[model samples]
Target chain A: MQVFKVYQQETLKYFHSIAILLFVTVGVSAQTKTDTTETKKKPTSFVPTGVRVGTDLIAIGMTRYVDSYKGWEVNADVDFSRYYLAVDVGSWSRDYDNGAEIYSNNGNYFRIGGDVNFLLKDPDRNMFFLGLRYGRSKFSESLQVNKIDSMWNNNPVNERYSNSNSNGSWFELTTGIRVKIWKVIWMGYTARLKFGLTTNEDGNLIPHDIPGYGRTDKNVAWGFNYQIFVRIPVRRQQ
Target chain B: MEFGLKAVNLSLQPRVSTMKKATWFIFLLIIIASCLNDPDCFRINSNVIGISFRVMGTGKSDTLRMYGVTTQNTDSTFYRNTAATGIGIPLDFTTTESEYLFQTTRGDYSIALKYDVNVQFVSEDCGSKYVLENLETTGHTFDSIRLVSRTPGTTAGGNIEIFRCPRTDTMAVAFRQLTLSGTTKSSQALVVETNGITPDFTGETLYGGEKVSIVYLPVNLDVDKHAMVIDFDQVEGGLRKLDLNYTLTETQRYRPCGVQIFASEMIINAVESQYAFDSVGFVLNETNSSIRSVLDPFDPMINIYRCPDLDIAGIYFRNRQDRADSTVSLKSVTVNFQTTNYAPTEPTTFIRVPLNKSATNTTVTIEYQTGKIETLVLSYTATPITRFRVACSDQNTLFTNLAVVAQGTTLVGSQVPNASLQSIPTRNIEIFP
Candidate 1:
């Protein structure tokens, strides 16, 4: 009973994540499998035609130039008619010192959802689409605070606090475009409005930032990613 | 060849146009992203809760004098020896529960509160802030407390109002004298000196060795009559008993105040004393149920009056060698050109003579039984004291520092003892002749 009570919150979080994934998969697959009896009369174009694999260039550039930031993200999508299934995986680590305190955090995150291409009939298969994603992160953070209390005889306070094995989740409404420059090489941007953020109660040490969701203080945060991709054809276009 | 080249250019035209548009979009996105900065530190946050006091029956604001209010974990005090109707206190931000100990004049009480703390690290420039919510009173030791607001603010009204019942058993009696102002009559407060006062119901002596014009006497809740004995000074039979009668009505006026006992229809039922009083009347007929001011609780329900005090000093002739009373014969005695019938037909050691209330000195002409007359001068300081208001100003004078400035021939010496003269007569000087 004691062990179950201790892990109850973690178990509930995992259950929610699994429920969202199942809902997305079942909903999309059910939509695609509709009217199969009329497939002989009208050919269905539901089969995946190509896959795009990409890496965020901005994250790489910040990792190289910004002293306090080190992070990278990879994105991939498989096309099914005018709709596509998208997935993202990323890792972030930050170390900051601002005279009064030292804070550091590191985490890994993943996002899975679907996107609908609005520019469906473009000859080059260039895309402008709006999508939704369910993102979850698992991370740990530590902070060391230093202060001098002038009221209490100038007493010096040096206290260290840390939160280990914390989990956070959020949802993102994404809008961007994917443009094809050449036969296989492609470039695009994804602008994300992230909201509905929640996290595990970690006693005292509140997290300054979530790995995939940016700052944890705000209710809604904005993100932009400039990505480069290579398109590999999985089947011949009908 | 010309046809092939033109077709290739046509195919590349849309591709080139799409690339240019994408470049512009990316450039605009980068510019907007670079402008996203952290928020400024401007908001003010506090973790304070307010508490106020009220009287149960009237729901009036009540003042409370607190010795101090402290928490278990900290040495700091919230309000130390501070008197206020409402006060603001801080809740512990580091924990979910807090308990405060209140030390007051009446007794010590405690209140425990439970809440949730939501801390947010806003930005690097703003640092962090905490908001306390779901404030609840888990336990308390006061007579009654009502939670007015769960989400407390920094206002002075406070979130909790503490209630206590008003005092209903005690009543005040004032001493006053009536004087004629031309054709009109007015009463002024008269200070009486007493050894002690004994209430018949409790049989306890109160306010011993003190001078008080107004006195608070308790009403016997079991009966309608309350009597007390006042011990006056320098009287043959010093005890004066006064019996008071009243009617008590028991009714629940307000549910929160509970059943209140009110006394009214007051009557000065009886007076048993050897000495006579000028008048005794009911000034305020009802026992006060509400306190108008915390500082002034005396509302005098009864007014007992005596004739105003006389400006006089008592002197006893004592032999300097033995410190014993000495007798001397006198034909006539005059004080400040006014003759007083104070000297007895026979020789006496003690005499009471009136003083000059407006003068610093008095001339006494003593014609000894030897038929030789001698003029003696007595010097003293008089301080004008007012008891009630400006209308009664200078109605009484306090004489002090009495001395014999001149003793006519045939007197050896004289000494001033107990220089201050009080309403009660005590020996003020001694003479060696």
Candidate 2:
């Protein structure tokens, strides 16, 4: 009787092994067939269900502590699958005094660009993007130029020009990455290369700083932004 | 999640250090290397082009005998070569044309050069600097003008080379006035009586109360001249008169209102003297060849001055026709004049006494051996209209002009010997002694 009971247990263990092997083979074949026949197409319900609004924290700090400078920038973006559309709006004002002269400018600028997120299907909704933007600003600049030291003449030659309204446009390429640090918070860094488009000419008063671009002396300029974003998902969960 | 946090740290820690280094590098590049908002307010900056003096004289002359260089009413003098060898003169940044006058005691000439100016922006601290390139000599008074450097830098090396002939007309003479270092070796009190100019500029002739040890007169008289004397006071042997027998020929043009073109030569009679030189006199001709420019009147543009009167005088030696042994020599002639400023203790004070007007009578004092001093007072004879000018190069031409002697042609204008004398505004009276 004991021998018969041990034979029965051995037979049941063999049958279980056979059943498990057949199940694995069928599952693997089914998965492979499904993968080979699958077409990658985005669904129709992609209406930017998530949005991230951010501000340049670095710029805020710079404007707060630095003299005669006041500026702030806000960035808002909406995601459509792997592509994100972003808009940057900023206003800058500077009352710069360099001992030789004083120049004051106040302007508002807007940048509209689209970013193609390279990090796809990430659980944390992070992104590495390559983007382009067309930036524009309408500004008024006033300058008071003092006379420089001269060997020929010693007269006080001071020139003042006020309310010189100017408009400038530029194209920029941006490379940046965003990392989700909290449940509803994110951080990002962007480096931008700006190519000039068009700007008004000032004979006596050269515009030193543009709202979207750094300086107008050269045809190209560089910019950097460190942002802190608050992520809000309307139809999706974080 | 706890293990996941550790994994995140592991992944990020290595990259953080690299990012930090890159950030520091970029920060340094922006902070230290970037230009600030300082703008150089100087719209124009001049470049310094250096010039030096070199003598092609094979006779081993020490330095070139040049008076000065003048441009834009500024004078740079090289008195007896008492300066550095090279000079870095400034170029006009506003214009491409520049003319400079190189003056010598005998004559003067113009140096003109053309250049294309380039402006480059330096840093904010320096503003900008002008670079002069494509330099070519348009006009010059030099024999050979060679470019030592294709583009001039701030090196002490000479840029423009001016070839000059060996000077043979230089003579060593002495003035009677004594200085601190005077022991009969150096010349003193160079008397310059510039005729054909307004006599008010330097106060020429002193008549009654005026006294002066030095004289630089501006005269507008066409017939104005000065009788000069050079002494051999330091000679070891017997006293003798100077042998400064030279020709004074000039090409002068007085224009605008009404002044005749005067071309004449004054010569000294050097008959039978033991010396080679007689009375020191020459016609330092107006050497500039251009007309008057509205900007600067004293430039080489005009060679005649608008004096009140135009009195032209030539040396007709009163006793040279006689050529007697008892004639007056330079040793028997000593001149005394007054200054423009009043010095209560000294008799050198003088003011501008017109040619028609007299200041103080000049006392001619002659001294011989053994403490013998003889004085000659030239009494005023109705305010002379013009004084006589004398010139001599060689002693042989000092004879009478009626005797058909050969005239000297050595004193030529620097521009040309027979250039057109029209509308000149400067008066140059050259003394050869």
Candidate 3:
């Protein structure tokens, strides 16, 4: 009976794994069907092999506070359609220190990357795109003290402090899916697991996320990204 | 039949959906475009317009006549012309009573007189009455007359007449002298009637001890003239009463009677010098001198001067030409020096002097150190009359002309060889050394 029970448990485990896989597959299939129906109504245009322009929002998560940054991004793939050269410009303001103090940062980001997409199913809609993004993320910080300094000294003083900038190379592998909503509108979600390849104070490869680094954590860190965009197609002369 | 029905249903459903999507997209585009094209705008405020008026006349006590209107519009383009009726007045004069009355009427106006003097009197016909007492006099001797009303009620509609007599015969003689002694010194006591004419009381005073005489003077109702005379012998130590009375007589028409003499005397001597520098490098030693009785001291002026081959510069003494209350006596003389050189030029400089005050009798020396000798000519010019006035009273008509008399000029120094000298006759020339 003990052996029978062990066999039955193993079977149950297998069924459970299969059910999870089926759930993910079916959910994706339903989404794909909707996208296909919408796309079929409009004329298809050639996707440019050399240029890709996109936008993104970065949620800065820290021990004390969290902030968001949103802006546009444009990229040119030079070598084969898989190699990407990108530029991202964005600005963000945050109240991290406390409600009494605030911080803001803004700059441009540039990257040279490569990506590969693998089709999981017969339909091109069920695919996972894996890309390595290598870019220089520059950041600046400006701090403003909204309240008087509360220290041993009775004197009340307000202060404004700022930092010029700091930039470093970053690399990340992002895997996501692209789903078409309308003929021109696209909806996508991605997961990026990144490593800084550069050193932190501990002399080890820094995690992707740090106070000064562009990401929230270092080594083996994962981030979920989402985006909605419209594709403006340029017509070719007959 | 089944196959046909299925085909029709499929085609109709897709067509309707496509049409709906296209229509929605077009509507969104139109709304967004409209919002982007519209914007807010602004405009500037308009400007306000204003008007003003001015009246000109002679003597300190002379009546100033002015008239104007306001159309209640702030437009600068609108204007009113009163040249034909002598009533063109700016809109700003609506505040003054005299200006208001003049603007409403297009006829001549004169200073109404009560006795021999001009006084303000109330009439029953007029809605309100205003009287300005102790009317100041212009420094020069002049006659002043104003409109007077004599009806008992507020509506005095009939013609009002005025008369004049010497102040010595009035009951308020002390008041006429501006002195309040034991008498009440009321101006009302001087009102009297004579020769079927009633005149109001007016004050008159002669400046110098000259004789006062009266002749029929042509009266210009539009421009009334007043003459005041004080006789030194008639008063105690030349302090005589200036009291005079006026009575109003109701007549069919307003007519001023014969001229009545109050007091006659010579005017106080107030002379002014208008000097000009000559081109021959000389200054005006003296200019024209105006003569009158010696009541006030004379004050001289350096009118104008010109450097040799240069410009002429000087200022006319306004005190001497116009009458002022403050005493202006000659204190000292100053000459501004300048020099200029022009080759091959014979410059003849002219200077005018008040009669007998020029440098003709005085020594005039001209010394040349560098330039060649040239002819030097000193010429004299009589002062021309600056202004002419006609004075008219009920019984006296007189014409007064003011002028600057020039004496002569004397030339000094040796003349250059072959240099001709000529003396020219002209008016209003100045040569000062």
Best by lDDT: 1
What TM-score quantifies how close candidate 2 is to the native fold? 0.36
On the 0 to 100 scale, the lDDT of residue B433 in model 3 is: 20
Candidate 3, residues B1-433: lDDT per residue as tens digits? 3554222222233333433443343334334433432211111001111111211121111122334333322122222333221122222111111211223233332321121111111111211111122222122111222323231121122122212211212111111111111222111111111111112122232223332221111111111122222222222222221111122222222123223322112122212211111110111223533221111011111111111110111111122233222221222222212132222133223221212222222121233333222222222222222111111111111111212132223322221211111111122222222
Candidate 1 scores an fnat of: 0.12
Computed on C-alphas against the true complex, the DockQ of each candidate is: 0.07, 0.01, 0.01
- Candidate number with the higher TM-score (1 or 2): 1
RMSD of each: 19.8, 28.7, 34.1
Ranking by lDDT: 1, 2, 3
Chain A TM value for model 1: 0.80
Interface RMSD for all numbered candidates: 11.1, 23.9, 39.6
Q: Which regions of candidate 2 deviate over 4 angstroms? A: A1-46, B1-433
lDDT (tens digit, per residue) of candidate 1 on A1-238: 4335324533543443344335434533443343222133445499998999999998999999999899999999999888889999999988877766678889999988888875444568777676899999999888776766343335465667777889999998776678888889999988676779999956657788888888764556667888999999999877
| Best model per DockQ | 1
Per-residue lDDT tens digits for candidate 3, residues A1-238, read 5335435544553443344335434544554454445433444333443333444433323212433333344333322222233333333332334454444545555655665543222232323355677656565545444443222122232444454454555676554555446665655654444456453222111122232224332223343445554544443311
Quantify how close model 3 is to the true structure by its C-alpha RMSD in Å. 34.1
Which CAPRI category fits model 3? incorrect
